[model samples]
Target: MTRHVSTRRAATAAGTAIVAAALIGAGLTTASAAPTAEKTPGASPTKLSASQRAELLRDADAEKARTAKELGLSSAEKLVVRDVVKDRDGSVHTRYERTYDGLPVLGGDLVVHETKSRRTEGVTKAHAGDLKVDTARAKAAPKGARAVVWAASGTPRLAYEKVVKSTKKDGTPSRLHVVTDARSGKKIFQWDDIRTGAGHTQYSGDVELGTKQESSGFSLTDTGRGDHKTYDLGGGTSGQGTLVAGDDDEWGDGTPANKETAAADAHYGAALTWDYYKNVHGRDGIKGDGVGAYSRVHYGNNYVNAFWDDSCFCMTYGDGEGNAKPLTSIDVAAHEMTHGVTSHTAGLIYSGESGGLNEATSDIFGSAVEFSANNKEDVGDYLIGEKIDIRGDGTPLRYMDKPSKDGKSKDSWYRGIGQIDVHYSSGVANHFFYLLSEGSGAKEINGVKYDSPTADGKPVTGIGRDKAEKIWFKALTTYMTSNTDYAKARTATLDAAKDLYGADSAEYKGVDAAWAGVNVKAAKGKNKH
Candidate 1:
């Protein structure tokens, strides 16, 4: 069953922040670079100078000592501290370290690098990207066991953090994982497991138990910093929000060896995506009605990608092998969740033009979510999949202005282009949405700069977001059905604009102009694929 707990300060102000992307095309060209985030989506990225680094390093070490004491750590444990990234969004963070309290009461050691967002302190991630808290309680001795956790660069502060579970000499972590809100210091999600018997011993061999060595410097997404990976992090939260449960769909095993790292990576992305929708669009859940979707990490056998299953209302991600990594980034999560939202509201057909529209809608909202979160670890940009890189070129998977840049999408929406994989075909709609929301010529909105353009030589105009979203939602739910085609989508959306935004509202004009910018029209000409 789902649980809904309120701590404090819940408001609807998000309605004002997040709107659909339908900016009018600027009619300009993109820059040579694939678009630098300028900032991570959550907190601002703070690069420390040599002198500053020394100071931060000192403070980090001291902080570790204080935290160890607070957690009742012993002297045999040695802890290492690092600064939590300060994203461009100016969020509150609680950075921790990986250390042991002398030797374990049992025969091992306790070390962790757990960081979390300080929501009670109002430490929100600007990019709406989630904050990852890395904590561990592994072995410290040379032969007994040792677990190493590398600090991910872009983590935000954790709030209302408490140890929900721990393993006694019995060897079971009956309970593990804690959950809290970023805006208010409330215990929205928590669990406490008491181990009763010896845990699985074979896991030690598969996980390099006593021989575990420290590995570092794995960037999660794009940005020169932020986005890290963990071999072991055990702990989880409710819903797909934090899938550390070691299910068939999960990518990693949430054991004492690796629970914290996995939880940090998965939950950071999920929470950030959640906040993006809630704070920006006033959406309650995937359907704007307060439903939480499950996010399963460590999916399948060495799976290499992440996917949103509309049928299951869940997202599954892999650990990536043979050069393939999990696509579970903030934008990626947003892309997947938006699918659920679209399925619920628009039910756009998954084939042909409507399919492309549906797919693009996911990309559109995903990017917007990144922008809304505005973190320093992961900034909002018009690029996709720059984090996982499935490609080794150190570039993103797709570009908004020129979908063809990815060598997969049609620059313009041709009538019959829907046969392609929805991932690729989504380019047409992605470009159109960007143009609609961030209308033409370069300028800064929410501290991020975006420049868009029209298909033809003409300059386009945009309808404001509030009206645009209402119109889009109306079109999807009221007029269109599962089999709706692109042509039908156009008609339905226009009709929707007229009904709610007024036949002459700029929103109405925008729907027309947006379609016009994409070369989508009523006629059955060459514009027809």
Candidate 2:
């Protein structure tokens, strides 16, 4: 079974369709470019004095110290700042985004704009009409952009460079400033904008583009290698990762120990996902570590959905009582396991746009894994969770070709798209993957008919999943983060294609065209496509 964000099966026991029949759904999360944020560079800020500026610098230094205290750096991580120009606009708005000790943040590429617009009366203080102050120049975000992601994480605080404001020729009658934390979307400072001599002026911060964050836990070298090690959780042994099953009542308990016989049906399914990645992607462990992640059989008593927890780094299983046998699925295993890999690598958050991309990334690679495994036990195909009969009628969970047909997923990106469940939100990337790998058309594999159309319903020929897998893998390793979503995913992958296939190479062109087919315009940055 394909382990995607959701387990789409027949609705029997409080079943969720992943995409509701009436909900009608969504796509790749673009970052928000609007004024939903507090203290946007173009937004107002907290007023400050020359003394305050000095204090702010002091505060930044203090932050540096705090970070060092909390996250001790290898001499390498202590000073590395991997900040580079990102986003549609080239350092276009906010002064600059910076990373402390090389920790990666979403704002490293986003330029923030905080401006104050106001009017003030001089000592003359006469009711002024034309003498009044107002904003004149308007700066727009760079063109060919998709969405803007603005958010705050519990960890990762946002830092600003310098603050600016508007004032009169002599001085300001009133003043304003805006301060924000780029990493966490937290507002640092703000103030008023008043007129003195200059009618209206906009202020900005010094762009200290943020660098990348160092790894927080368990490094790649931390885990051992190969079948040399057997994983023992509480019960038994699993060579690396395993897929176990349970009775209708007790679903995947994997117990790390076995209770009843390890369900062959469940074992085979999980094995497909495990061996697929190992044989196809050459990924020994989900994180490329030799450490084995145990797959517990029968997760819950008649459980409905399967999931991955970073804390455990393993995929769990579930039984579909009455109408579902989700444990006996291939894509589901791959989908869940990939979540482990993502947790280790990009570590995208599980909410909002980042959540959607996180889910989609799992599905994309899961589908690719299915393609690579080509196992006769679980024949490799594009259909997600084809083995699990949620409907009890033998129909699979979700379809990769026309996700919308499943009634839970959206085929394209649109406004208010983030509202859908991440499982459904995955459509944008799922569709993009379909476009990249197979293009748009009705192709039959394993007798599964897949007819996928581009965003505009136009047909797009693809580069096939084999190459697509490599390119996407490269992107995940080189350009993504815990916060990356669909738009960023596309950008990262396009950039990856060029890196792996050579600039302007056929492979790169194929990737660019694939995104275009999905209606995502090619962008720059690591975004080569």
Candidate 3:
């Protein structure tokens, strides 16, 4: 079975598949960059403001021709800037998508880093060399496939990339990207882009919501965070439902019986996620563009899932079993929104090792967002989907402290891990983050007892969650690429640590130790753990 989002398998369940098929018949398609480290490192990194980011983007675009020439690319090859990040020291990291002869080049994304003095430091690329494949050799793409250059993992070749949009059995939308060999028509790689999470009627208690005061009543629109709005999907599986509104500022009674209760949860979750990114990480919004992504609650009847669809750029939550349990939990909301952030920045392709990293990134930030909220009703814990009771067993969907506790996720990295479902494969990074933030060994946090074990039987000393999350955020935004794997992730974090806290700092050592705890060791002679 394929993995869609979060912890569940992707194959629609027995009766669920029929629902999914019916949703498909009605068009239920939904779904869902560079890590780099400083080379000519300077001062402590500070995130760029919205205007600065926009200006840098413009500058990057103006220099595209120069960049192409410096990289010695052919005339047929062109570069389009996807994102640009400026460090506190004036160094710039620019991410770009590539096209060859006016054709999209899959796996052709790359990042170029420039020192403060404007000297090119280095280039991180998904495809290492120039495109040599002949477009003439490309055959017709199957049905919905689009011709392109497959350069994500292996050798650059002519390929067709197709996005299959469908609904999963659990009402989890699937935006599956399937790449096939253009000549042979053989499947090369595939990944589901739809990422999931959820909210109250269960998680957060009575909480304040950001709403717009309309003449008639109050609308579930938060003007403070890019005018983010929440809507009620009613029981339909397609299209955005009506914007949730009320006659007064007050909303929800802390129960699923009140439809506005779910909307309040969803809205509150979006606000928390927005504030967490803006306040802690300096990210203005999911795209760092100050434009908020809306949310949809009460998706399908007993849908049993919540997901983020990049196509609509919105969060969708379902009414879990019997419509009594809404999948609108704080952590789940944060988790799903982080997928949007990942899409805008690292652009991690949703498959294999990269896909695992993609999911782990969301989980990591989801936990961080929860802890940041510090709500009395739902104290922070290193557990995912705990409030939603996704499995009906009163256990979380995943445990970061020890991922294997759930029985499906792997706690450590191993060979062929890329072949497993991404949700399970994400365990390695999740464990690493936990060990990095809280260290290895038995301990209790927020009334939750955890006994984290190391794969190598080595004790890992933590540098605290604050420093840990900072290192991760830097690594993800600066060093990571769509094709980065486990080893690459380790290096990226290490590099991020060196940039943030110095190479000799304990935080850097902690990162190394944490990676080691997950059995992803640094290369020979570079092992500091």
Cα RMSD, each candidate = 21.7, 22.4, 10.8
Could you give the candidate ranking by lDDT, starting with the highest?
3, 1, 2
**Highest TM-score scorer:** 3
Q: lDDT of model 1 at residue 94? A: 29
How many clashes does the backbone of model 1 have? 94
Q: lDDT per residue, candidate 2, 1-529, as tens digits? A: 0111111211222211001000011211111212121111211112222343334334333343333232222332222121111111111111122333343233222211111110110000001011111112111212321122122333333334232434223211222334344444456433221100000000001111111122442111112223221121222222233322112322223321233222333333345555665555445566454455655544444444555544455555545453135343556666776776665555455545666666777777667766565555456666666666555666666666777877887778776666666667767777877777776776666656677887776667676676677667656544565446566677668655654555556666667666776666634443333
Which scores higher on TM-score, 1 or 2? Answer: 2
lDDT per residue (tens digit) for residues 1-529 in model 3: 1111122112212221000000001101010001224343443445556777787787778778778777767998999999876676777778889999878887788887766656676676766666877888555666777889888867888888899888776667788888888778799998877776442334688777888989899899999999999999889888989998888888888888989888988899899999998887778899887888999988888887787788899988888888887777778888889989988888888778898888889889889988899898888889988888867879888899899998888999998999887788899999999898888888778788888999999998777787678888888887787887888788778877887877877778788888989999765432222
**Best candidate according to lDDT:** 3
* Per-model lDDT: 0.45, 0.44, 0.78
Would you estimate the TM-scores of all the predictions?
A: 0.49, 0.55, 0.89
lDDT tens digits, residues 309-425, model 1?
A: 554465545554441344556677667666666655544545445566776776666666666655655667777766656566777777775677777776566757766656566
Q: Looking at model 1, which ten-residue stretch has the lowest summed lDDT? A: 18-27
lDDT of 3: 0.78
